[model samples]
Target: MPMRLTKLLGIELPITQAPMAGVQGHALTVAVSNAGGLGSLPCAMLSADALRNELTAISRQ
Candidate 1:
């Protein structure tokens, strides 16, 4: 069966990695996304430049 959340998010799986503010990063988010899940990038603690870089990294993954 197709996963509902996956369809909702346009991801390959229903899993969603938590946007753990201090612990999650670009590499981890990419890994989760690559594994067919929604990888969340938390921006609450990041500087503008850091968020931009992380977004770029995620896009490249």
Candidate 2:
């Protein structure tokens, strides 16, 4: 069978932690990516400059 979402993501389940900037961190983003499901982030709350920083940091990881 095709890999389920979690297996495809290298995680135990096909779930993601929210990308809550106030609470979530880079570790959470990479973790979800590594685990397979998409991670959530609140880009709307970020200013353009802040978004740039967040994107840059995630890209580096």
Candidate 3:
């Protein structure tokens, strides 16, 4: 069956990587995005520069 969340999110799959404050990093987020899932990156505890770098990395992935 097709997942509505996938359609809504415009992803191939409905999977969403949790935004684990310390655990979710750029690599894991990019990997999940590469696999056609929603990759969530937590920015609450990140420095502005770090978040920018992570965003830049994820955008390239």
Judging by TM-score against the true structure, name the best candidate: 3
For candidate 2, lDDT tens digit of each residue in 13-45? 567676575766566787677676677666777
TM-score of each: 0.82, 0.59, 0.85
Which parts of model 2 are misplaced by more than 4 Å? 1-13
Tens-digit lDDT track for model 1 on 1-61?
4676778888998788999998879888888888898888899999999999999988886
- Which of candidates 1 and 2 is the stronger one according to lDDT? 1
Query: Model 2 reaches what TM-score against the true structure?
Result: 0.59
List clashing residue pairs in candidate 1: none
For model 3 the TM-score comes to 0.85
Residue 30 error for model 2, in Å? 1.6
Model 3 weakest 10-residue run by lDDT: 1-10
Candidate 1 deviant stretches above 4 angstroms: none
lDDT of 3 at 54: 92
Model 2 lDDT, residue 46, Cα: 82
